[model samples]
Target: MAKNQRRSVTVTLLYVFFIINQALTDGPRFVEPIPNVTVPLGRDANLPCVVENLGTYKVAWIHIDRQMILTIHRHVISRIPRFSVSHDNAKTWLLHVNNVHKEDRGYYMCQVNTNPMISQVGYLQVVVPPNIIDSLSTPSSVAVRENQNVSLTCKAEGFPTPKIMWRRGDSQEITVRKRKVAVYEGEHLNLTRISRTEMGVYLCIATNGVPPSVSKRVVVDVEFPPMIWVPNQLVGAPAGTDVSLDCHTEAHPKAISYWVRDNVMLLPTKKYGADLTENSYMAHMKLTVRNLQATDFGNYRCISKNSLGETEGSIRLYEIPMPTTISRPTEVRSQLHKENLAKRNVSKISQEERVKSKMMSSYDSDEINSHREIENRHESGNGYHTPSSPQLSGCISITRWTFPQFAAVILNCFFYHCRV
Candidate 1:
């Protein structure tokens, strides 16, 4: 019985030794291949290297591009502050790169210290957002004269080589080659023969496939001298009346505008007031002359001045006589013609007959009574008055009236009495 037990124990010992030898010869093996990693710039990245059956073996991480070892086992070997190493369950080794940069992009290898030195490589892609280079790009503000050529340039840097676009800051369309477009794509935006309409803020945008694109504002100022436009060169107003004269001007650099009369600058006062309204490059200037007198009538000028130059527009102010109750000869004739037209029926009376009949009817109503009251004192025995009489001696009765009305009455009477 003792001999049999000894043999059985020896067999058990051999089986145990065989198992230990097999475990030792197995070495380390990759459980899964390392997967490629993509991380944005300034972010952390974790590279996983899973292993199984590892016995007395150490895992390592290497930068294949630089041929530098980054980590070994649970300890970090790279001098870079962002490099770190960690493992879970002694099987999954993780290599950490914090705050990744463009220079950190390349191939990374997860290696195991084995008889044959097994390793697996993965690509670490670091993507960068767009960044504008101010020193090499257009300035924040640029000034150019009108009808001059100008160019705006933009420069950018990124991992994917950023694209550039130019557009107005006000969200308005840009004029390119005489064609209006909502957006322009190019590093350089050239404008030939620029005008005041193009003076405003412009946007320089740089973008790539990466998130958080960048942009800059460039102010394009168009400068020009003062130019005046006069709406009315001649203005007439009667005495004791108020009048307003206006002048429009366009200029850059914000021109100073004022009103001038006889080389004297007009100020704001009770008798005279001056006003100026401005809108960017355009200004509206007004001069109000209150209770105008004879002395206030003269040539007045609206003057505008800027750093570029000066310009002036003139207006002539003249006095008109005060109105009276008496109408002029032309006015009387116009009235007579209007009355004749009003008395016309749809049948349309003849012009001569209408004129004679209208004048007689008006005389009967407005002059007949006055003529009768004075007829006795001015009547002579021959039923006619002398030439000096106030009542005109004509076939039609005439009374106190303007010379035009009296002459028209006599002419119509002659035409009616002598009709063929």
Candidate 2:
């Protein structure tokens, strides 16, 4: 019973010692400083504050910018629904900002209700994506006349101040300030003396190193009168052949293209066919004439008309004479050989005639003398003449014959007379 009494007294002494120590060090003091937080807009943010020895002392959060208390202990003081506070039950306090907005970005204070009223400050950063302001920006579409100056404007709003750039939607180059560039780094794009070639969609891009970069499209329309270019102004084709005449036209608001012949509109038919191909602002006009006749050779007009003006191009269709091919010597040689074969089988020729016949058979078909002799034979009677006759026989001229040919003729005559 005495030992049990001693043990109880010792436990009472240790409890008293612990209570005295708690009374000496029982005050809320920050153990870890608050850390700055950065979060995107519409996201939650948590600012932590750690303290030690907090014994019944109230912990509070304050908005340094507004100089207002956000929370006290576990009760929220701010009426804003998005502001709240929590703790780890052991000295760590958290300030919660739900669905943070731009106004929430500022310095936040983690405070403690002590004799000295200790506090620490942390910053809250809220970032926002780029957004284009259409009210202050250029319109969706802009119309201008040819050779006129034009300007495009862009406006945007975002955190960190968005940077604006200009570019062409078609990925083509832009002429600005007497220079050409793929991208123009400015809020305004200025064009001087704008032509049809410079008309297209212009894009205004805004970014701030954040997600969801945005852009706006502005269309630039340039109006112009109708103009035409004739690829084949003077087309030549032979009779009974096919020919095509072409004309290229450029205009705005689309253009009507057609072909006119002798003040009459030419329609699609078996002999005359008209066709048109169109691009954005350019058109190709073609007229086809099948089985060209003598009457088809004339001037044809390609006409293009638009809301601005009308233009026409003239093309002259002329006849190109077809090439004439002369018959080859082989055909003439074949005819001569056929006639010589008939003469040899039908009647017997004299020795002189035989010599002449052999020479004629071996003659080069290219020589005109052979053809002339054969023609003379057909004109004369029996192609022969007697000694008393004044006319020469239908044979190769003796003056034109070679020495070998003359000797052969002489020998043949001599032998023939000897035999007689």
Candidate 3:
């Protein structure tokens, strides 16, 4: 009798302990953060919810959007890769799903164990195929000086993979494309020994079974053979206030730009300059010369070309004048323009420059003062001059631009100045 009484007492004590533990801080329960979620086709996704005062209340995951119910997880839930439960800060819960199928697209619910409380809803959206890119861009469009390394790429992103093709405008003197025996990524069309004939519009086509195929045009430009330009530049720049250079082209078969110093491509970072407008052929290409150094001096050009022609313009970037006082930053940019404007007139470049003259006119300044101002302020330490003039607005209208798109630019000929 005594032994039985002691056993009964021990059982009662254990039961009391269990009740106390359950009644602790598991006060109220709630879920938060997401009310909706978006997912792409053939990709993994995660849905999260939380439970507060999680003592007495347990968390459960459920499908709230589906016509038929789907339970993802429970306190004593199943453990599978397609679905897994997790906790954060020992409070909230989450469900992750891999290889999301089409039918798996719907709303989910997160509920906690409580009285008349504890429920949250989340929606999932599955993105279909045939997405179009708004527009295209490239690194830089330079008139290659005389002779230098010409590296360029065509970058595009869409639902379907894009196919790139190169062609010329005026003449078809392009380097004979070696019939390929193998497939290569971007590297197949190498212009290591590029000339004027290797310039044109490199078209990028994105296609899927859906309606019309989407495409992006990239213009390539080669110039000057590859030489030099002269200007003062700050070698090093601060984190937030870094002055940079920009290159744009209105040519087909886009141009490739790089940041070369001591015969090397310089990576743009906190201090060093960078090759801006990357992987774009037909549009604008820009490079930011960072952490300016005296050695970064010499000829810097916007080299660009296509199968029909090649062109380059030199802009020499020298070292910045060290700070003599604390001023509000400064930059000096300068441009050299003349009435002659080279209509293929230079004896050495008569045949070539003439064909390129119309091409160069797009880059030439009708308001020579404005371009000169851009160049003058560029070299001095007076700080960067962001063009905020109403004349040069970036408001993009839906209507298509024929020559601007074909030329790789839309020179803002605001009626104010009216330069033909």
Among the numbered candidates, top TM-score falls to 2
Error of 1 at 173 (Å): 2.1
250-313, model 2: which lDDT tens digit per residue?
Answer: 9987888899999999999998888888877788888999999999999999998888899999
lDDT of the candidates, in the order given = 0.86, 0.85, 0.52
Question: CA lDDT of 88 in candidate 3?
Answer: 72
**Candidate 2 vs. true structure, TM-score:** 0.72
Clashing pairs in 2: none
lDDT of 3 by residue, 330-396 (tens): 3221112332455325755776556556654653433344446657877885675545443334423
Judged by whole-model lDDT over C-alpha atoms, candidate 1 comes out at: 0.86
> How many clashing pairs per prediction, in order?
0, 0, 97
lDDT of 2 at 57: 82
**How high is the lDDT of residue 222 in model 3?**
55
Candidate 2 ranges beyond 4 A from true positions:
1-23, 325-420
Q: 15-97 in candidate 1: lDDT tens per residue?
A: 99999899878878898888888888999999999998887788999999989999889888889989999878868988999
Give per-model TM-scores.
0.71, 0.72, 0.26
Once fitted onto the true fold, the runs of candidate 3 whose alpha carbons sit more than 4 angstroms away are 1-26, 67-81, 131-420
2 or 3: which has the higher TM-score?
Answer: 2
